[model samples]
Target: MSQPYLAPAELTAEFCGRLLDALDAPLALDHVCVDFQAVKSLDSSAVALLLEWHRRAQAAQRQLELMHLPSALSQLIKVYGVEEFLQIKA
Candidate 1:
Protein backbone atom coordinates (compact mmCIF):
# COMPACT_ATOMS: atom_id res chain seq x y z
CA MET A 1 0.00 0.00 0.00
CA SER A 2 3.00 2.23 0.22
CA GLN A 3 3.73 2.25 -3.47
CA PRO A 4 2.34 5.33 -5.22
CA TYR A 5 0.67 5.36 -8.63
CA LEU A 6 2.45 7.96 -10.70
CA ALA A 7 0.96 7.62 -14.14
CA PRO A 8 3.46 9.16 -16.48
CA ALA A 9 2.70 9.95 -20.14
CA GLU A 10 5.00 7.10 -21.14
CA LEU A 11 2.80 4.15 -20.46
CA THR A 12 5.70 1.76 -20.70
CA ALA A 13 7.67 3.76 -18.20
CA GLU A 14 4.77 4.60 -15.93
CA PHE A 15 5.45 3.22 -12.47
CA CYS A 16 5.68 3.98 -8.79
CA GLY A 17 9.35 4.75 -8.52
CA ARG A 18 9.15 4.61 -4.75
CA LEU A 19 8.11 1.18 -3.56
CA LEU A 20 8.54 1.60 0.21
CA ASP A 21 7.26 5.05 1.03
CA ALA A 22 4.60 4.00 3.52
CA LEU A 23 6.23 0.95 5.02
CA ASP A 24 7.07 2.55 8.33
CA ALA A 25 5.39 -0.15 10.38
CA PRO A 26 5.29 -2.85 7.77
CA LEU A 27 5.88 -5.53 10.37
CA ALA A 28 2.89 -4.38 12.38
CA LEU A 29 0.45 -4.51 9.51
CA ASP A 30 -1.48 -7.71 9.12
CA HIS A 31 -1.44 -7.37 5.38
CA VAL A 32 0.10 -5.32 2.59
CA CYS A 33 -2.17 -4.70 -0.34
CA VAL A 34 -0.84 -3.44 -3.65
CA ASP A 35 -3.35 -2.18 -6.16
CA PHE A 36 -1.90 -2.60 -9.61
CA GLN A 37 -4.90 -1.67 -11.73
CA ALA A 38 -3.46 1.70 -12.67
CA VAL A 39 -0.27 0.17 -13.90
CA LYS A 40 -0.76 0.30 -17.66
CA SER A 41 2.50 -1.50 -18.22
CA LEU A 42 4.74 -3.70 -16.16
CA ASP A 43 8.30 -4.91 -16.51
CA SER A 44 11.13 -6.60 -14.66
CA SER A 45 11.27 -3.77 -12.19
CA ALA A 46 7.72 -4.49 -11.11
CA VAL A 47 8.48 -8.15 -10.64
CA ALA A 48 11.55 -7.33 -8.62
CA LEU A 49 9.58 -4.99 -6.43
CA LEU A 50 6.89 -7.59 -5.87
CA LEU A 51 9.44 -10.24 -5.04
CA GLU A 52 11.14 -7.96 -2.59
CA TRP A 53 7.91 -7.24 -0.80
CA HIS A 54 6.94 -10.88 -0.79
CA ARG A 55 10.25 -11.85 0.73
CA ARG A 56 10.05 -9.16 3.36
CA ALA A 57 6.51 -10.05 4.31
CA GLN A 58 7.36 -13.71 4.46
CA ALA A 59 10.35 -13.05 6.62
CA ALA A 60 8.23 -10.96 8.95
CA GLN A 61 5.49 -13.60 8.99
CA ARG A 62 3.06 -11.18 7.40
CA GLN A 63 0.91 -11.22 4.24
CA LEU A 64 1.11 -9.38 0.95
CA GLU A 65 -1.79 -9.30 -1.43
CA LEU A 66 -1.68 -7.89 -4.91
CA MET A 67 -5.07 -6.61 -6.00
CA HIS A 68 -6.48 -5.69 -9.38
CA LEU A 69 -3.45 -6.92 -11.21
CA PRO A 70 -3.79 -6.05 -14.88
CA SER A 71 -4.02 -8.88 -17.40
CA ALA A 72 -0.73 -7.85 -18.92
CA LEU A 73 0.92 -7.86 -15.54
CA SER A 74 -0.49 -11.25 -14.71
CA GLN A 75 0.67 -12.60 -18.02
CA LEU A 76 4.12 -11.23 -17.42
CA ILE A 77 4.25 -12.85 -14.01
CA LYS A 78 3.11 -16.20 -15.41
CA VAL A 79 5.59 -15.94 -18.22
CA TYR A 80 8.28 -15.36 -15.67
CA GLY A 81 6.97 -18.39 -13.77
CA VAL A 82 6.60 -16.39 -10.60
CA GLU A 83 2.89 -16.88 -10.00
CA GLU A 84 3.54 -19.21 -7.10
CA PHE A 85 5.93 -16.76 -5.58
CA LEU A 86 3.53 -13.86 -5.86
CA GLN A 87 0.88 -15.78 -3.95
CA ILE A 88 -1.67 -13.30 -5.20
CA LYS A 89 -4.61 -13.34 -2.81
CA ALA A 90 -8.10 -12.23 -3.75
Candidate 2:
Protein backbone atom coordinates (compact mmCIF):
# COMPACT_ATOMS: atom_id res chain seq x y z
CA MET A 1 0.00 0.00 0.00
CA SER A 2 1.04 3.56 -0.54
CA GLN A 3 1.94 5.89 2.29
CA PRO A 4 -0.92 7.75 3.90
CA TYR A 5 -1.47 11.34 2.87
CA LEU A 6 -0.41 13.51 5.76
CA ALA A 7 -2.60 16.46 6.55
CA PRO A 8 -0.97 19.76 7.32
CA ALA A 9 -1.10 21.30 10.77
CA GLU A 10 -3.74 23.71 9.56
CA LEU A 11 -6.46 22.64 7.14
CA THR A 12 -8.15 25.96 6.55
CA ALA A 13 -9.56 27.17 3.24
CA GLU A 14 -6.18 28.53 2.19
CA PHE A 15 -4.43 25.19 2.49
CA CYS A 16 -7.15 22.80 1.38
CA GLY A 17 -6.51 23.38 -2.30
CA ARG A 18 -2.93 22.35 -1.92
CA LEU A 19 -4.00 19.16 -0.25
CA LEU A 20 -6.54 18.50 -2.97
CA ASP A 21 -3.90 19.06 -5.61
CA ALA A 22 -1.64 16.62 -3.88
CA LEU A 23 -4.43 14.06 -3.89
CA ASP A 24 -5.02 14.32 -7.61
CA ALA A 25 -1.99 12.22 -8.34
CA PRO A 26 -3.04 9.46 -6.02
CA LEU A 27 -6.66 8.98 -7.01
CA ALA A 28 -5.74 6.21 -9.38
CA LEU A 29 -4.96 3.94 -6.49
CA ASP A 30 -7.65 1.56 -5.32
CA HIS A 31 -7.40 2.85 -1.77
CA VAL A 32 -6.28 6.13 -0.25
CA CYS A 33 -5.59 6.98 3.35
CA VAL A 34 -5.39 10.47 4.75
CA ASP A 35 -3.64 10.94 8.08
CA PHE A 36 -5.13 13.69 10.17
CA GLN A 37 -2.96 13.35 13.23
CA ALA A 38 -1.04 16.53 12.53
CA VAL A 39 -4.07 18.69 11.99
CA LYS A 40 -4.27 21.08 14.92
CA SER A 41 -6.98 23.34 13.51
CA LEU A 42 -9.66 23.22 10.87
CA ASP A 43 -12.83 25.04 9.99
CA SER A 44 -15.99 23.88 8.21
CA SER A 45 -14.19 24.51 4.97
CA ALA A 46 -11.91 21.63 5.76
CA VAL A 47 -14.92 19.41 6.13
CA ALA A 48 -16.12 20.54 2.74
CA LEU A 49 -12.79 19.73 1.22
CA LEU A 50 -12.83 16.27 2.76
CA LEU A 51 -16.31 15.65 1.49
CA GLU A 52 -15.23 16.73 -1.95
CA TRP A 53 -12.32 14.34 -1.80
CA HIS A 54 -14.66 11.57 -0.77
CA ARG A 55 -16.91 12.37 -3.68
CA ARG A 56 -14.01 12.25 -6.06
CA ALA A 57 -12.90 8.93 -4.67
CA GLN A 58 -16.39 7.53 -5.05
CA ALA A 59 -16.55 8.73 -8.60
CA ALA A 60 -13.27 7.04 -9.32
CA GLN A 61 -14.44 3.82 -7.70
CA ARG A 62 -11.77 4.16 -5.05
CA GLN A 63 -11.85 3.87 -1.28
CA LEU A 64 -10.99 6.81 0.94
CA GLU A 65 -10.11 6.32 4.59
CA LEU A 66 -9.37 9.15 6.99
CA MET A 67 -7.03 8.15 9.78
CA HIS A 68 -6.07 9.58 13.16
CA LEU A 69 -8.61 12.33 13.02
CA PRO A 70 -8.32 14.84 15.83
CA SER A 71 -11.07 14.69 18.44
CA ALA A 72 -12.41 18.13 17.60
CA LEU A 73 -12.58 17.34 13.92
CA SER A 74 -14.21 14.00 14.67
CA GLN A 75 -16.86 15.79 16.67
CA LEU A 76 -17.43 18.24 13.87
CA ILE A 77 -17.88 15.40 11.40
CA LYS A 78 -20.25 13.63 13.76
CA VAL A 79 -22.23 16.82 14.27
CA TYR A 80 -22.62 17.02 10.52
CA GLY A 81 -23.66 13.35 10.37
CA VAL A 82 -21.02 12.51 7.79
CA GLU A 83 -18.77 10.15 9.65
CA GLU A 84 -19.90 7.26 7.49
CA PHE A 85 -19.10 9.14 4.34
CA LEU A 86 -15.77 10.35 5.59
CA GLN A 87 -14.89 6.88 6.87
CA ILE A 88 -13.10 8.18 9.94
CA LYS A 89 -10.65 5.72 11.41
CA ALA A 90 -11.11 4.58 14.98
Candidate 3:
Protein backbone atom coordinates (compact mmCIF):
# COMPACT_ATOMS: atom_id res chain seq x y z
CA MET A 1 0.00 0.00 0.00
CA SER A 2 1.08 3.58 -0.61
CA GLN A 3 1.87 5.97 2.15
CA PRO A 4 -1.16 8.02 3.12
CA TYR A 5 -1.73 11.58 4.21
CA LEU A 6 -3.97 11.03 7.19
CA ALA A 7 -7.18 13.00 7.07
CA PRO A 8 -8.51 14.80 10.11
CA ALA A 9 -11.62 13.52 11.95
CA GLU A 10 -13.56 16.65 11.04
CA LEU A 11 -13.53 17.60 7.40
CA THR A 12 -15.75 20.59 7.56
CA ALA A 13 -15.34 24.04 6.00
CA GLU A 14 -13.89 25.35 9.22
CA PHE A 15 -11.06 22.86 9.02
CA CYS A 16 -10.68 22.76 5.27
CA GLY A 17 -9.10 26.20 5.08
CA ARG A 18 -6.35 25.18 7.45
CA LEU A 19 -5.93 21.88 5.72
CA LEU A 20 -5.57 23.57 2.35
CA ASP A 21 -3.00 25.97 3.69
CA ALA A 22 -1.04 23.05 5.11
CA LEU A 23 -1.08 21.28 1.77
CA ASP A 24 -0.40 24.29 -0.41
CA ALA A 25 3.22 23.36 -0.88
CA PRO A 26 4.41 21.56 -3.97
CA LEU A 27 3.77 17.83 -3.99
CA ALA A 28 6.90 15.75 -3.99
CA LEU A 29 5.22 12.48 -4.95
CA ASP A 30 3.74 11.67 -8.29
CA HIS A 31 1.03 9.73 -6.58
CA VAL A 32 -0.65 11.11 -3.48
CA CYS A 33 -3.01 9.09 -1.32
CA VAL A 34 -5.21 10.59 1.36
CA ASP A 35 -6.43 8.14 4.00
CA PHE A 36 -9.81 8.78 5.56
CA GLN A 37 -9.53 6.16 8.26
CA ALA A 38 -9.57 8.86 10.89
CA VAL A 39 -12.37 10.86 9.35
CA LYS A 40 -15.43 10.19 11.47
CA SER A 41 -17.27 13.32 10.39
CA LEU A 42 -17.46 15.42 7.27
CA ASP A 43 -19.60 17.85 5.30
CA SER A 44 -19.79 18.97 1.69
CA SER A 45 -16.44 20.61 2.23
CA ALA A 46 -14.91 17.17 2.04
CA VAL A 47 -15.80 16.95 -1.61
CA ALA A 48 -14.39 20.41 -2.22
CA LEU A 49 -11.20 19.39 -0.51
CA LEU A 50 -10.90 16.30 -2.67
CA LEU A 51 -11.63 18.27 -5.79
CA GLU A 52 -9.05 20.90 -4.97
CA TRP A 53 -6.50 18.25 -4.15
CA HIS A 54 -7.30 16.48 -7.39
CA ARG A 55 -6.92 19.78 -9.25
CA ARG A 56 -3.53 20.38 -7.73
CA ALA A 57 -2.37 16.84 -8.45
CA GLN A 58 -3.58 17.10 -12.01
CA ALA A 59 -1.89 20.44 -12.48
CA ALA A 60 1.37 18.77 -11.48
CA GLN A 61 0.65 15.84 -13.74
CA ARG A 62 0.35 13.63 -10.70
CA GLN A 63 -2.34 11.28 -9.45
CA LEU A 64 -4.41 11.70 -6.32
CA GLU A 65 -5.91 8.72 -4.52
CA LEU A 66 -8.53 8.53 -1.80
CA MET A 67 -8.48 5.63 0.61
CA HIS A 68 -10.87 4.28 3.21
CA LEU A 69 -13.49 6.96 2.61
CA PRO A 70 -16.27 7.33 5.14
CA SER A 71 -19.65 6.20 3.80
CA ALA A 72 -21.11 9.69 4.18
CA LEU A 73 -18.24 11.26 2.29
CA SER A 74 -18.66 8.69 -0.43
CA GLN A 75 -22.34 9.48 -0.64
CA LEU A 76 -21.59 13.15 -0.74
CA ILE A 77 -19.27 12.69 -3.66
CA LYS A 78 -22.04 10.90 -5.47
CA VAL A 79 -24.63 13.45 -4.51
CA TYR A 80 -22.44 16.18 -5.92
CA GLY A 81 -22.05 14.19 -9.12
CA VAL A 82 -18.32 14.45 -8.84
CA GLU A 83 -17.52 10.79 -8.38
CA GLU A 84 -15.99 10.71 -11.81
CA PHE A 85 -13.71 13.57 -10.92
CA LEU A 86 -12.13 11.79 -7.96
CA GLN A 87 -10.13 8.60 -7.61
CA ILE A 88 -11.63 6.77 -4.68
CA LYS A 89 -10.00 3.40 -4.06
CA ALA A 90 -11.89 2.38 -0.96
Candidate 4:
Protein backbone atom coordinates (compact mmCIF):
# COMPACT_ATOMS: atom_id res chain seq x y z
CA MET A 1 0.00 0.00 0.00
CA SER A 2 1.08 3.59 -0.46
CA GLN A 3 2.21 5.70 2.48
CA PRO A 4 -0.50 7.48 4.36
CA TYR A 5 -0.85 11.24 4.33
CA LEU A 6 1.06 12.95 7.11
CA ALA A 7 -0.78 15.17 9.50
CA PRO A 8 0.67 18.53 10.45
CA ALA A 9 2.51 18.93 13.74
CA GLU A 10 -0.33 21.00 15.10
CA LEU A 11 -4.05 20.29 14.75
CA THR A 12 -5.29 23.03 17.01
CA ALA A 13 -8.29 25.30 16.55
CA GLU A 14 -5.99 27.99 15.16
CA PHE A 15 -4.89 25.74 12.34
CA CYS A 16 -7.67 23.23 11.70
CA GLY A 17 -9.69 25.75 9.71
CA ARG A 18 -6.94 25.95 7.16
CA LEU A 19 -6.51 22.22 7.27
CA LEU A 20 -10.21 21.76 6.60
CA ASP A 21 -10.02 24.17 3.72
CA ALA A 22 -7.14 22.21 2.29
CA LEU A 23 -9.27 19.08 2.27
CA ASP A 24 -11.83 20.68 0.00
CA ALA A 25 -10.13 19.06 -2.95
CA PRO A 26 -11.54 15.78 -4.18
CA LEU A 27 -9.98 12.61 -2.85
CA ALA A 28 -8.08 10.68 -5.49
CA LEU A 29 -8.56 7.27 -3.90
CA ASP A 30 -11.37 5.23 -2.46
CA HIS A 31 -9.62 4.84 0.88
CA VAL A 32 -8.00 7.81 2.61
CA CYS A 33 -5.53 7.15 5.39
CA VAL A 34 -3.89 9.85 7.48
CA ASP A 35 -0.89 9.36 9.73
CA PHE A 36 -0.70 11.34 12.94
CA GLN A 37 2.91 10.64 13.81
CA ALA A 38 3.85 14.29 13.30
CA VAL A 39 0.95 15.66 15.25
CA LYS A 40 2.47 16.81 18.52
CA SER A 41 -0.52 18.76 19.75
CA LEU A 42 -4.23 19.09 19.07
CA ASP A 43 -7.59 20.03 20.55
CA SER A 44 -11.30 19.47 20.04
CA SER A 45 -10.86 20.99 16.62
CA ALA A 46 -9.01 17.89 15.62
CA VAL A 47 -12.08 15.85 16.38
CA ALA A 48 -14.18 18.26 14.40
CA LEU A 49 -11.82 17.94 11.47
CA LEU A 50 -11.99 14.17 11.61
CA LEU A 51 -15.75 14.28 11.72
CA GLU A 52 -15.82 16.58 8.76
CA TRP A 53 -13.41 14.40 6.87
CA HIS A 54 -15.51 11.36 7.62
CA ARG A 55 -18.57 13.18 6.40
CA ARG A 56 -16.88 14.22 3.21
CA ALA A 57 -15.51 10.75 2.60
CA GLN A 58 -18.93 9.21 3.12
CA ALA A 59 -20.49 11.71 0.77
CA ALA A 60 -17.93 10.76 -1.84
CA GLN A 61 -18.34 7.02 -1.23
CA ARG A 62 -14.86 6.81 0.20
CA GLN A 63 -13.45 5.52 3.47
CA LEU A 64 -11.39 7.44 6.03
CA GLU A 65 -8.76 5.84 8.22
CA LEU A 66 -6.64 7.44 10.92
CA MET A 67 -3.40 5.94 12.15
CA HIS A 68 -0.84 6.53 14.89
CA LEU A 69 -3.03 8.84 16.86
CA PRO A 70 -1.35 10.47 19.84
CA SER A 71 -2.61 9.33 23.22
CA ALA A 72 -3.95 12.76 24.01
CA LEU A 73 -5.91 12.85 20.80
CA SER A 74 -7.23 9.37 21.47
CA GLN A 75 -8.33 10.48 24.92
CA LEU A 76 -9.97 13.55 23.54
CA ILE A 77 -11.93 11.47 21.06
CA LYS A 78 -13.02 9.12 23.81
CA VAL A 79 -13.88 11.98 26.14
CA TYR A 80 -16.01 13.56 23.49
CA GLY A 81 -17.68 10.18 22.85
CA VAL A 82 -16.99 10.35 19.14
CA GLU A 83 -14.91 7.23 18.73
CA GLU A 84 -17.83 5.39 17.22
CA PHE A 85 -18.06 7.96 14.48
CA LEU A 86 -14.43 7.60 13.38
CA GLN A 87 -12.32 4.75 12.05
CA ILE A 88 -9.01 4.70 13.92
CA LYS A 89 -6.38 2.04 13.37
CA ALA A 90 -3.21 1.07 15.19
Candidate 5:
Protein backbone atom coordinates (compact mmCIF):
# COMPACT_ATOMS: atom_id res chain seq x y z
CA MET A 1 0.00 0.00 0.00
CA SER A 2 1.09 3.58 -0.55
CA GLN A 3 1.86 5.85 2.37
CA PRO A 4 -1.09 7.57 3.92
CA TYR A 5 -1.99 10.81 2.17
CA LEU A 6 -1.60 13.85 4.39
CA ALA A 7 -4.45 16.23 3.91
CA PRO A 8 -3.87 19.97 3.61
CA ALA A 9 -4.69 22.22 6.56
CA GLU A 10 -7.42 24.02 4.71
CA LEU A 11 -9.82 21.57 3.11
CA THR A 12 -12.10 23.76 1.06
CA ALA A 13 -13.37 23.93 -2.47
CA GLU A 14 -10.31 25.85 -3.64
CA PHE A 15 -8.09 22.86 -2.97
CA CYS A 16 -10.41 20.30 -4.50
CA GLY A 17 -8.89 20.46 -7.96
CA ARG A 18 -5.38 19.95 -6.69
CA LEU A 19 -6.44 17.13 -4.39
CA LEU A 20 -8.34 15.43 -7.19
CA ASP A 21 -5.38 15.85 -9.46
CA ALA A 22 -3.20 14.06 -6.97
CA LEU A 23 -5.66 11.18 -6.84
CA ASP A 24 -5.53 10.96 -10.63
CA ALA A 25 -2.08 9.48 -10.34
CA PRO A 26 -1.93 5.74 -10.87
CA LEU A 27 -2.07 3.81 -7.62
CA ALA A 28 -1.01 0.18 -7.66
CA LEU A 29 -2.14 -0.60 -4.15
CA ASP A 30 -5.32 -2.43 -3.23
CA HIS A 31 -5.97 -0.26 -0.20
CA VAL A 32 -5.35 3.42 0.51
CA CYS A 33 -5.65 5.62 3.55
CA VAL A 34 -5.90 9.38 3.77
CA ASP A 35 -4.56 10.95 6.94
CA PHE A 36 -6.57 13.94 8.09
CA GLN A 37 -4.43 14.92 11.06
CA ALA A 38 -3.22 18.10 9.39
CA VAL A 39 -6.63 19.20 8.34
CA LYS A 40 -7.87 22.00 10.60
CA SER A 41 -10.71 23.28 8.50
CA LEU A 42 -13.37 21.59 6.41
CA ASP A 43 -16.46 22.45 4.44
CA SER A 44 -19.13 20.73 2.46
CA SER A 45 -16.75 20.75 -0.45
CA ALA A 46 -14.27 18.74 1.56
CA VAL A 47 -16.92 16.16 2.25
CA ALA A 48 -17.69 16.08 -1.44
CA LEU A 49 -14.02 15.55 -2.20
CA LEU A 50 -13.83 12.61 0.18
CA LEU A 51 -16.92 11.10 -1.36
CA GLU A 52 -15.47 11.53 -4.81
CA TRP A 53 -12.25 9.88 -3.76
CA HIS A 54 -14.20 6.99 -2.26
CA ARG A 55 -16.07 6.63 -5.54
CA ARG A 56 -12.83 6.64 -7.49
CA ALA A 57 -11.30 4.08 -5.19
CA GLN A 58 -14.30 1.84 -5.62
CA ALA A 59 -14.11 2.22 -9.38
CA ALA A 60 -10.46 1.23 -9.25
CA GLN A 61 -11.36 -1.84 -7.17
CA ARG A 62 -9.50 -0.54 -4.13
CA GLN A 63 -10.50 0.21 -0.58
CA LEU A 64 -10.33 3.72 0.82
CA GLU A 65 -9.89 4.37 4.52
CA LEU A 66 -9.88 7.76 6.15
CA MET A 67 -7.50 7.81 9.06
CA HIS A 68 -7.18 10.17 11.99
CA LEU A 69 -10.30 12.00 11.07
CA PRO A 70 -10.93 15.03 13.27
CA SER A 71 -13.98 15.03 15.50
CA ALA A 72 -15.44 18.00 13.66
CA LEU A 73 -15.03 16.27 10.36
CA SER A 74 -16.40 13.07 11.76
CA GLN A 75 -19.47 14.90 12.94
CA LEU A 76 -19.85 16.43 9.54
CA ILE A 77 -19.58 13.05 7.90
CA LYS A 78 -22.28 11.73 10.19
CA VAL A 79 -24.39 14.76 9.47
CA TYR A 80 -24.00 14.11 5.80
CA GLY A 81 -24.94 10.46 6.36
CA VAL A 82 -21.85 9.00 4.67
CA GLU A 83 -19.94 7.43 7.53
CA GLU A 84 -20.55 3.93 6.17
CA PHE A 85 -19.48 4.88 2.67
CA LEU A 86 -16.35 6.70 3.80
CA GLN A 87 -15.34 3.86 6.11
CA ILE A 88 -13.76 6.26 8.57
CA LYS A 89 -11.06 4.81 10.77
CA ALA A 90 -11.46 4.93 14.50
Candidate 6:
Protein backbone atom coordinates (compact mmCIF):
# COMPACT_ATOMS: atom_id res chain seq x y z
CA MET A 1 0.00 0.00 0.00
CA SER A 2 1.53 3.30 -1.09
CA GLN A 3 0.16 6.77 -0.38
CA PRO A 4 1.12 10.41 -0.82
CA TYR A 5 0.19 12.93 1.84
CA LEU A 6 -0.33 16.32 0.24
CA ALA A 7 0.70 19.62 1.79
CA PRO A 8 -0.45 23.12 0.93
CA ALA A 9 2.98 23.82 -0.48
CA GLU A 10 2.48 21.01 -2.96
CA LEU A 11 -0.64 22.59 -4.52
CA THR A 12 1.19 23.71 -7.65
CA ALA A 13 0.85 22.31 -11.14
CA GLU A 14 4.41 20.94 -11.34
CA PHE A 15 4.19 19.26 -7.97
CA CYS A 16 0.73 17.96 -8.74
CA GLY A 17 1.95 16.50 -12.00
CA ARG A 18 4.82 14.73 -10.30
CA LEU A 19 2.51 13.35 -7.69
CA LEU A 20 -0.11 12.21 -10.18
CA ASP A 21 2.58 10.70 -12.36
CA ALA A 22 3.54 8.51 -9.43
CA LEU A 23 0.04 7.13 -9.01
CA ASP A 24 1.02 4.08 -10.98
CA ALA A 25 3.66 3.07 -8.49
CA PRO A 26 2.95 0.26 -6.00
CA LEU A 27 0.28 -0.70 -8.48
CA ALA A 28 -1.32 -3.05 -6.05
CA LEU A 29 -2.62 -0.18 -3.99
CA ASP A 30 -5.83 1.58 -5.00
CA HIS A 31 -6.36 4.50 -2.68
CA VAL A 32 -4.89 7.96 -1.99
CA CYS A 33 -5.51 10.03 1.14
CA VAL A 34 -4.90 13.74 0.72
CA ASP A 35 -4.27 15.78 3.85
CA PHE A 36 -5.69 19.25 3.40
CA GLN A 37 -5.47 20.64 6.90
CA ALA A 38 -2.60 22.89 5.95
CA VAL A 39 -4.10 24.16 2.74
CA LYS A 40 -4.94 27.83 3.02
CA SER A 41 -5.79 28.42 -0.60
CA LEU A 42 -7.89 26.48 -3.08
CA ASP A 43 -6.83 26.41 -6.73
CA SER A 44 -8.11 24.76 -9.89
CA SER A 45 -4.90 22.81 -10.26
CA ALA A 46 -5.32 21.39 -6.82
CA VAL A 47 -8.89 20.42 -7.59
CA ALA A 48 -7.60 18.83 -10.75
CA LEU A 49 -5.12 16.93 -8.65
CA LEU A 50 -7.84 15.40 -6.55
CA LEU A 51 -10.07 14.90 -9.55
CA GLU A 52 -7.21 13.37 -11.46
CA TRP A 53 -6.48 11.09 -8.60
CA HIS A 54 -10.10 10.09 -8.43
CA ARG A 55 -10.10 9.66 -12.18
CA ARG A 56 -7.01 7.52 -12.12
CA ALA A 57 -8.27 5.59 -9.19
CA GLN A 58 -11.50 4.80 -10.95
CA ALA A 59 -9.72 3.97 -14.16
CA ALA A 60 -7.27 1.83 -12.23
CA GLN A 61 -10.05 0.25 -10.17
CA ARG A 62 -9.23 2.13 -6.97
CA GLN A 63 -10.36 5.00 -4.79
CA LEU A 64 -9.30 8.43 -3.51
CA GLU A 65 -10.09 9.90 -0.08
CA LEU A 66 -9.28 13.23 1.42
CA MET A 67 -8.17 13.62 5.03
CA HIS A 68 -9.01 16.55 7.26
CA LEU A 69 -10.28 18.72 4.48
CA PRO A 70 -10.42 22.41 5.14
CA SER A 71 -13.71 24.23 4.66
CA ALA A 72 -12.40 25.86 1.54
CA LEU A 73 -11.44 22.61 -0.08
CA SER A 74 -14.68 20.99 0.87
CA GLN A 75 -16.64 23.89 -0.52
CA LEU A 76 -14.65 23.89 -3.69
CA ILE A 77 -15.20 20.20 -4.30
CA LYS A 78 -18.89 20.65 -3.63
CA VAL A 79 -19.05 23.58 -5.98
CA TYR A 80 -17.45 21.56 -8.71
CA GLY A 81 -19.88 18.66 -8.17
CA VAL A 82 -17.00 16.29 -7.49
CA GLU A 83 -18.02 15.42 -3.98
CA GLU A 84 -19.71 12.30 -5.18
CA PHE A 85 -16.94 11.23 -7.54
CA LEU A 86 -14.14 11.77 -5.08
CA GLN A 87 -16.12 10.60 -2.07
CA ILE A 88 -15.51 13.91 -0.37
CA LYS A 89 -17.15 13.23 2.95
CA ALA A 90 -14.48 14.55 5.24
Span of 10 residues, lowest total lDDT, candidate 4: 21-30
**Model 3 lDDT tens row, 1-90:** 246789999999888877874444535544777789999778998888888888888887877777788899999998888887786533
- lDDT winner: 2
lDDT for residue 22 in candidate 3, whole number 0-100: 41
Give all TM-scores, in the order shown.
0.68, 0.86, 0.86, 0.86, 0.86, 0.70
Arranged by lDDT with the best first, the candidates are 2, 4, 5, 3, 6, 1
Candidate 2 per-residue lDDT, tens place, 20-54, comes to 76676687865888898899889877888889999
lDDT (0 to 1) per candidate = 0.62, 0.82, 0.78, 0.81, 0.79, 0.67
Off by over 4 Å in 4: 24-28
Lowest lDDT sum, 10 consecutive residues, model 6, at: 22-31
How many angstroms is residue 28 displaced in model 1 relative to the true structure, after the best TM-score fit?
A: 2.9
Clashes per model (N, Cα, C within 3 A) = 0, 0, 0, 0, 0, 0
lDDT of 5 by residue, 1-90 (tens): 778888899888887767875564534455787888999887888888888898898888888777888888888888999888887643
lDDT of 5 at 32: 80
Poorest lDDT segment (10 consecutive residues) of candidate 1: 4-13
User: What is candidate 2's TM-score against the reference?
Assistant: 0.86
> Candidate 3: TM-score?
0.86
Clashing pairs for predicted structure model 3, backbone only? none
Query: Taking the tens digit of each residue's C-alpha lDDT, what string does model 4 give over 2-77?
Result: 4577899999999998887444454555477788999988999999998888888788777777888899999988
Which lDDT tens digits does candidate 1 get at residues 7-76?
A: 2222242443565443326546566665665665567666666677778878878777777777776777
**Stretches of model 3 off by over 4 angstroms after superposition:** 24-26
